[model samples]
Target: MSLAIVDAREWQNLLDLRTGKKVKDDDPRVQAPQTATLRDVLRRHPYPGDSDPRSNRWVTDSALDLVAAYEPQLACVVYGHQYFAGRYTPMTDVQRKGMMEELFAEIDRFVARSGYEPVVVGTGDMVPLEGEIDLGKLEGLAISSHWSARYAGLHRATPRDLDHVRSLAKVERVVGRDEWLAAFPDAEAVPARVPEHLLLAEEGWTFVTTGTPMRRPVRVPGRGFRIPLSTRLGAAPSLLDIRGLVLSGAAAGKKVALIVAEGVGMNDFLLPFTPCANQTGWHYYEPGDGFYLTLSTGRHQVFAYPSGYNYLDETDEKKDLPFSGYFLDFPAHALGDDFPGKSVAAGNHSMFVHMVFGADVCMECFARNLYNQGGFGVIHRFR
Candidate 1:
């Protein structure tokens, strides 16, 4: 009993409304005669899968940009021309493996100067490497599906298989499709820039879902669905600025993970912990009370509250700012608004999860940002 909640036509309708591009109602050219539904749209625009040929041109740029926005420390490469890709290509499995190896080495060199790690994102097929890559030694990593993976007649990777590959790489998520492959009426092709502009324009709706079963909030068969973020974008609690902590060692010892609330923004909460003090990094305090910093040396430090019961600000008499070994900071940008206060006409719910770490350092600002997005509801130190 799968639920069909969002419709693909909604994608076109929302695109038209946001861009002011007039798409005909039931226009046969956009493939309307057969009445393509949201499920059909979803199939075509599968999650984690590469975009269709028509949609690939713009999506690649958007996808690369999206990865860069979050993982600034990581680098990438875009391979395979649109026309020459797909399983039917004359390339052999060994030849493809060699191609990937060469590409991976190039990314390694790019990050070598910066002392960061690079992960290769590809379009189709999830190949597992027999050896493990020392991710901690590298800055960060990312891999994704290629556009050719979405072709109607090509061999594409499945989410289940992708999930397995992610586990091998210790990655938790993969952007992928929600349903099977679909077909639609032939009409004016959706411009490559449409989806990118819609997201950037903030014309669609954003939904938040919490503590619900996976795949709930089923959509109506024909309506389009919304892009459900894992966390929210509300203003976070103010805390000590983290820009100055300036840890001298490599980030190899510094750890960070995502703590997301269903349908919320990505930076909802980032908590790095250490058990040097209480064997648990969870900070507990009463309302209006200041949070103490417990150092690895067993020393206790205190922070004072501002007049408004928030973190210490200018008006507070406490001249000393207690340095919490951990720091917190909000993401620099929100999805932004379409035209100001207009609800993004989206059709899905959000997903939520908390970040748990095993080590700790100065992370006050980082923790505060997470708590501000949506109070840190859960804390776990291990996966």
Candidate 2:
């Protein structure tokens, strides 16, 4: 099994006690050297572009625009931390849906191009997705809590939820122990849904997933012991038309999300069919009430800031255009907000404005002017 641990050291870095417990931007404690850690992992993989195994890390894609970048044809598996990396908050259900929707859309493209499916297992965090799934009509449902079983230090599982999903998916056939590995050698035995042999066809690369038939345990801060949750809320229920709902967003015209790690050795993701960049390249909202058309219940305030149009310029090369930035604050209900008033949730408090890259706005030239005027990094494109 090709196992790639993403942000393992970074996770450790953030969790380190010496640092403040919370991981956030502007925190200097977690800023230890990460390049070395990234390079060490990439060394094991085949390097593409100007291949040289001796050089531990791969080249930065600038904006993650390069293709034919990776050398290995292996399945490009991505592992991410749920609480921090996944960027979830307790208050927003829309953002939670958007996050997974974005992830699924990104993975679908990778699967189509690379012929390898992206596996999304758990990363020990039991933060619910903040959304609801209707499973009353389904025959059963199965939920897998952790990512790859072998890679998890703390064993976590959810069997009852798995059975619910199985009922909903109408899954039949549980592979017996004797023929399980032989039939589906590559597939991990998931305690939910169909058995190993039942899932595999005569030939096809298989992905194995397993979950403990137990509720995930969660610890309340300042509390003494961990409590078992009924089910993993993040686990999406498999439905009859599940394929249709899953693939609808991948239809077309969607701007691909390109994730790049400058010094970190984690592989960059060239995700097409992912959500388009926000007006300022920060927030992604559902287009409409329908799966694809749903927009956010509230709009972000940062979009009101003037976005920089560097693509308007013709010559400067030193400045980096923002493909996307981070959120300054979650939406707040106070005045000076633009989100729909009907929304019970507060308006977006603030957002990170990412400048457009390449020749789109001639931003390269614009950035030089902005920097010369000592106005660099100020949102200005909207104006």
Candidate 3:
């Protein structure tokens, strides 16, 4: 992946922390000179978002576009993060319901062109959890109320084969996984391991989600509410027919969610998908940082900054962006300050929403953008 975007990266000069000495690029201790730590090239790039390329649209999209451009080179299996990649035909905008038919058909075309057979797996998001593990308690960490499982490093065992999703999707494999991978090809490859698909199941019922699935209005253009799917909040859930899943789950008294296993590697993913390309001998490029950015949230602030780390922890060392200064007296006119009359923002993200928007009432879930605990929301309303 580093080699794929070599031209765009800004290779970092090395330094020995303890001795305060400069480390040469060829130093034996430098296992990965372009690692996330050393790769100043990757750290500054943003995530996928809108055309504007800020945090939501601008910041996130730049990061995502980086991935779409480079990750495919890392592995043909990635074949581009969106199904649209490797498409033999151009996509025509259609209603949401027609999307699958259009997608599957194009996927079939790519298969035919590539000399590969289509796995056409019919899958659902619903699966039962036989047991659970809490990283918060085990690791002695504080769980984010919005999405505790993420910080807690919660773990669960999903069936190696999702017979349930296949039974529903009908042909063979599960449809989608809630959490998607980062694909910023140009941005510094910010290292984000992975987060679980937000799910809550009890008494034979389960609800799994991948976007801001809490109390909020997503759309109604005529009424003056329009959330662009380009922003992290809008972009993610917009990718899938989450409404159908929620409705189906509600009707059946059972919910559907993508299932996964931890410590699983790419070899397992290769079972149904194309293998990532081997570009070592295939390509010859040198020296640039691999950026890491989370391209999944925000409306505009992302573009306002070069990377997404600003939204995570205020106390965390602020990179390219300015200090959050949470306790400092915020000017009445910070970026997202709205009506003097109480304003509210609710979604699945945790610290980010409160930090960026400064809303009077900030409600969240998907605890800290990591956990998926359900049946509630974390509401922060000013008295």
Best by lDDT: 3
List the candidates ranked by TM-score, beginning with the highest: 3, 2, 1
TM-score of every model versus the real structure? 0.19, 0.20, 0.22
Off by over 4 Å in 2: 1-67, 85-88, 117-120, 123-125, 128-383
Question: What do the candidate models score in CA lDDT, each in turn?
Answer: 0.20, 0.21, 0.23
TM-score-better candidate, 1 vs 2: 2
Model 3 ranges off by over 4 Å: 4-94, 120-383
Model 2 lDDT-worst window of ten: 342-351
* Model 2 lDDT at residue 45: 32
RMSD, model 3, all Cα superposed?
22.4
Per-residue alpha-carbon lDDT of model 1 for 126-159, expressed as tens digits?
A: 2212222121211221111111111111013344
Supply candidate 3's per-residue lDDT for 342: 31
List all candidate RMSDs to the true structure.
25.0, 23.7, 22.4
* Per-candidate clashes, comma-separated: 63, 51, 68
Give the per-residue lDDT digits (tens) of candidate 3, residues 1-383: 00111112223333432232455657544444323321322334422211111212221222233223222111011111111111112334343224333333433433333332122212111112222222122222212222111111112314432333223321211112122122223322223322232122222221222222242211100110111111111112321232222223334432111111111123212233322111112110000000000111112111122211122343444232121222222223322243223333322222333333343332222121223232111112222
Model 2 residue 356 CA deviation in Å: 36
TM-score of decoy 2: 0.20
